[model samples]
Target: NLLHEPVTIASVLSVPTVKENLEYVIHSSASDRLKIDGIGFIGARKVHLYFDPPLVKEVAYEDMSAYPLTENQIILRRRHGYTWRELLGPLKVIGVDTGAGAVKVNGEDGVVVAQVMANINVALSTANTQLANNNKSHSAPAPGASVPAGVGGAGSDFLNDLAEKKKTV
Candidate 1:
C-alpha cells in the first residue's frame, strides 16, 4: 500500500515562467515507475511540488475512487514548520513510485487505494489558505515575503471555495 511507504518530495522544478524552455529530467526516486500513458520523466516537473525546508506536511484523504482505483484527493491535515498555522493542508502527492515494484501477499490480496492531487489545484488551495492567514497575522508581512499567486484580494471564488472545502476535511 502507498500509505505504508514514506512519501516525500523527490524533485522540484523552479518554473520561472511557462515560456521558459524546460528540460526533461527524471527524479531518482520514481525513475523506474511505469504507467500506460508514457514515461514519468516528460511531465516530471509538473507533477512534483516544492516545499520550504524543514516543513513536513501531514497527509489526509477524503474518499477512494473504485473504478479508477485510487483515493479521491489528498488533504492537508497539519503543517510543521516555523510558522505552520499560516500554512494550509500538509499533504500534496506528486507522483507514485510504481517503479519500486509491488509486494505480493501469498495467502490473499486486498485492494489498496492511493491518494492523488493535481499540481495546480493543490498549490492554489494552499495559497488560498496562506493568504487568508496572512490577513489575520501581522498587519505587514516581513520585508520581501514572497507573494504567492492569487494575491489579489483573497483570490478567486473558486479559491475561497477550496479554502472552505479544506476546512471541512
Candidate 2:
C-alpha cells in the first residue's frame, strides 16, 4: 500500500501568479506527462478562485466548474505554503517497481477502484505531527516544576498532556 513506501518530497514548483499564462503552462506540462507515461498528471492543474467581499467574507464563489482539488495551492502574493487539513485522509497503497520485471503481492488484490501516481509526497501528515509535538514539548514546563493548588496550572496540564502523548506515540 502507499503506506508501505517511504515518503519524500517528489517535486517543487514556483508560480509567481495564478494568471492564465501560468495555468496554461501547467496544463501543457500535464499533457506532456500523459503523452510520455500514459498516466495522467491531474495534480498539475491550477485553479483561480475569486470571491466577492474578498476579506472576512462568510461565503466564497468560484469561477471555474467542478474539478478535483489540487494536490496543493499557492496564493498569488501571500504565504508560500498552502495546506488543506480538512481534506486529509489516511491512505493504503502499494507501489510496484516495474523495473524488477517481477511482482510481489503483500496482500489481496482486486480491480483498482482509483489510482494516481503524481509527483507528490505522502509524509506531510507525519511531518506535521512531529512538528506539533516538538512545539508542545518545547513550550512545556519542566516535569518537576511546582503547580498551583486550586487550579490545574499550565505546567501540570502540559506535563500530563506530554505523558499522554508519549504513551500514544
Candidate 3:
C-alpha cells in the first residue's frame, strides 16, 4: 500500500512534473485497486494524493479509466468545480524538456519553464518563510497591549464614525 511505502523527499524531487510523480507513486505502490480521492501540486515538485481505504490487488495502468495517457502527457480529469480547460484555456499544454530537466507551461503571455526540483525547493522555502512571518504577526500579544495601526485604519475609522453620526441623526 502507498501508506506503508517509503516515499522520501528525494524520490519526490526526482520527478519533473506533478503528473509524472503521481503516476510513479501509483505504479510503485503494492496496492493495485486504488481510488484516488484527490491530488494537489504544492510549489512545483510536491505531489499529494488522497486515497480511499480497503486496498485491493494492483490494477494495470490501462485499466485506470480516470487517468488517460496521451503520447506526450496525461490529461487530468476535471474535479472540485475546477477544470484544467478553464484555468489554462482550451489549449492547455505542458511540455517537458528532459535534456534541461525542466517543465514548461504554455500560457497566453509566454511559455514559463523552470528547473523542476530546484524551483520547487525555492518556492517551498519562500512559502515557509512567509508562513512563519504570518504566524509571528498573529501571535497573542501581552495583556493590555494595543493593536498596531495598519494602513487605511484612520480612513476606515473616520468612515465608521461618519456612519454612526448619520444613524444617530
Candidate 4:
C-alpha cells in the first residue's frame, strides 16, 4: 500500500571522474531507497534530477524468493514516496571527514567526504508523527481489533480484543 510520484533534483557525485547534472527522476516503493545512479529524466523538468552514486559490495537480498536474507545481503522492502527536499525544500548540507581524500585514496589528492544526503520528506520527518498535530482522524487501528470496512471506534476496542484472545489461549 505505497504510492510513488515522479520528481527531479540536482546532485553531485563523489567520484572526480564523473560530472553532475540536474535531471528528472521517478521515485517509488516503500522505503524510497533508490540507487541515485539508476534514475533518469522525464520531460521539461530537467531541473528535476536524480542523485547517482557508486555502489560498493555489501550483502543484500536481491528478491522476495529469499525472504529474510542475511543483513549484509538483505534488501529491505520500502514504501514509495518523494524525497524530503522535494516535498519540503532544499536541505542544508553538512561537512564530514572520511579520513582520506579522493586523491589520497585513489591517487588524486585533497578531496573531502561531504555529509551524506538524507531524504527527510514530509512523510519521514518528525513533523509527520502521529503525536505531532494529533492526527486522530486517520488514526490506525489498535492491535488484534478487527476493523470493519469503514467503521470507526475507540482505540480501546482493539486492546480489549487482544485481552480476550489472550485469556482464551
Screening candidate 2 with a backbone cut-off below 3 angstroms (N, C-alpha, C), the clashing residue pairs are 1-93, 1-94, 2-93
Clash number by candidate, in order: 3, 3, 3, 27
lDDT of 4 by residue, 1-169 (tens): 2448655555432322211213423222223332221111111111111121221122211222132212212122223333323332222212111112222221333222122243345336434544554764333334444556335555445445544576566
lDDT scores in order = 0.29, 0.28, 0.30, 0.29
Q: Which candidate gets the maximum lDDT versus the true structure? A: 3
Which RMSD does model 3 reach against the true structure? 19.5
Q: Between prediction 1 and prediction 2, which has the larger lDDT?
A: 1
For 72-134, candidate 1 gives per-residue lDDT tens digits of: 122222222223213332211222322232222111321111212233544565577568777
Whole-model lDDT for model 3 versus the true structure? 0.30
List clashing residue pairs in candidate 3: 32-57, 32-58, 32-59
Residue 140, model 1: Cα distance from true site in angstroms: 9.7
Tens digits of per-residue lDDT, candidate 2, 56-110, equal 1122212232233242332222111222111322111122222222222233331
Model 2, which residues run further than 4 Å from truth?
1-7, 20-60, 66-169
Q: Is candidate 3 or 4 superior in lDDT? A: 3
Error of 3 at 137 (Å): 53
Q: How well does each candidate superpose onto the true structure, as a TM-score?
A: 0.17, 0.16, 0.18, 0.19
lDDT of 3 by residue, 68-137 (tens): 2222232223223321221221121243322325454332222221111222444465577448656322
Task: Order the candidate numbers by lDDT, best to worst.
Answer: 3, 1, 4, 2
